[model samples]
Target: MSSYLIRNAQILGGAPQDILVDGGVIQQIGPGPTVEADIDIDATGLILLPGLVDLHTHLREPGKEDAETVLTGTQAAAKGGFTAVHAMANTTPVADNATVVEQVWQLGRDSGYCDVHPVGAVTVGLEGKELAELAAMHGSAAGVRVFSDDGKCVDDAVLMRAALEFAKSVDGVVAQHAQEPRLTEGAQMNEGTVSAELGLGGWPAVAEEAIIARDVLLAGHLGARLHVCHLSTVGSVRIVRWAKSQGWDVTAEVTPHHLLLTDEMVRSGDPVFKVNPPLRTETDVLALREALADGTIDAVATDHAPHPDADKDCAWAVAAMGMVGLETALSVVQQTMVDTGLMNWEGVADRMSHRPARIGRLTGQGRPIAVGEPANLVLFDPAHRSVVDAATFATRSRNTPFRGLELPGRVHATFLRGMPTVLAGELVDQGDLS
Candidate 1:
């Protein structure tokens, strides 16, 4: 390990200051600190923030190696300025049991790219029928604090209530995908004029809102916590807002794509624009942005689903549902939220880093850049502009929709425990990549 000093950097939308890091902790943050380190980074015009944390990320390990692996996924996360990401348990072998969950956790630790917390599956194999070994997974070496049936909805009310009750005993949260399977059966895209015109099955707003409404009340009744994943509709936002007002232990997250893009992008007939809880209307997008700004939404997590090119290049009806989001999350946030005056850089840090960390219970991540805090940080060049190029991505999948789109703000460096895991937008392998 080496020491470093980031000089004259803007600290989380604050004034420019010098920060010193040694032994993986911030030693000082002041004007012209009289300290020396093994390395010096002249971040004169950069913004320094606590490393971003993604509460929802799919690593696709223990199965699906052709799409992505823990090593490649974490590398992509590091390149995106994330110090920690909770890996969704929708892998090939599903992280439903202790053995699989611990394997995923150990792989993340061995990779040394970013902190990976495995989210345990709420149901066996995510079938939404039998409950998984929740207590066993929570007690495993992974110490799983979050359980979810991410790719599928835990739609059975009794089963959902049971999961919520079980989470209460372990202080864990049940993160629901929030889509009513019946309403979304064979759903192809957002339910509106566009889907009707394209002859595609519509996924209506009520499908998501209905599930959220049920789960929040269930959580309140069970005295447990519930988190809504990738909330996409205005009605859903309204429900989450009302739920919060009612003093329910409920938190919700919106993906970067939902915040920036909309159902209009699907008009191109590109599968890259397809996503679960599909891209919504402009009104929904506006409502979600407002909700995120007003604290109705707790965090902005990247549902960074990656897929092989063959799986994503098909027709709209048959294509995969997701986009590669890790490497471009901050840029999208800067373009959609910060630059639009809806949020500042500090708010970006909060939504992307601090809040997600708190929601997922990741202790060493999302800390403020102050003396004695862990040196998990990101150096961002706000003025830098770059076109999204999937060919250059660190992930194995090239499913990004932002290709050739000019995006503002670039992640210059990401330091995990005082070591630069990503430098100048490229991943630094610590003997992990073959």
Candidate 2:
């Protein structure tokens, strides 16, 4: 309903160009546009990219609204320059059926901040014993194309094979959490010297690798799409690389935390550093970074699990295993990947926007920044730097591990289909569209 002219923004970190948006689509791009518009944004010294897309995010709604709701989560996503995100299915009621998945989908539709695609659960209650109503959920109005038991692993070989087969029929992907529960039982942190000195239970890398190895083989055999969620270990990276070598439809994601943080931070005894497929050794982090740069890793998912302060502010062993990542994802990427000279902004857009959108089979959200494409875009000031403050975050939860750390880059504005959900580094109220 509104038209905009973004002036002198660097497209994909390339030469600067002025872009015009009208009727929710990009209308023109050049040194200057002849068309008039309601709003004109000066984007000098900023990089414009296709709005980001997260393949893994936890919008803790339906039961954990105190932690995060679709509205708040998507607002956080907008703040992070993400125009689309896949909501993981590990909710209180568990999005295992059409009714629940559709409810989540409708909530996302109402949010109006970003597109929220609901991920259906792989098994009922994430029990891993019986496959959930995958076909039914896929056919529902939610139209879930990705299924996962994210907080839990679909460990049963027979059931996992069955899920892969079922997803194949629907042209969907099965995203596996890839942790062996038995091996990680009572695990408090990454299994390493830090954990040994901290006197915490160690979560061996083998636990995650073994599951990925088995699932990749199963997917290869079934000829179905398999996505490894929050893949953390070097061994897991090797497995995914080999799977891709075989030309299997196997893809893997590395979390922003895994890319930037490490088990050494766990020594602080801070619960914020704790996470599922927990932060690994420096060697693992370096390997994950290289894998991502080389395209061995498909996308950079936030896995933005949020927990109430009460849940994360206690002793390390009893604290929740996650970090609030949505708001800080891009800054972390800029610091870890771009500034390190390991990747350029074009590569960042590919890993964060294009690949994730393709992996989730999303439409209209990850298109190129060209005339006639949907105007889902982000303007970022890479030169800007600021100290992290969780208090300023848009998410309902304040569990970010980057709190107090200075991070590079900032999202100056984010447009969703030509409407500014976030402008001048602040959120715009779209009003209730539900």
TM-score of each: 0.98, 0.99
lDDT of 1 by residue, 181-256 (tens): 9999989999999899988889999999999999998988878999999999999999999999989999999998
Please list the C-alpha lDDT of all candidates, in the order they appear.
0.91, 0.93
Clashing pairs in 2: none
Model 1 clash number = 0
Off by over 4 Å in 1: 431-434
The model with the greatest lDDT is 2
Q: Write the per-residue lDDT of candidate 2 for residues 53-148, one digit (tens) a residue.
A: 999999989899999999999999999999999999989899999999999999999889999899999999988879899989999998999999
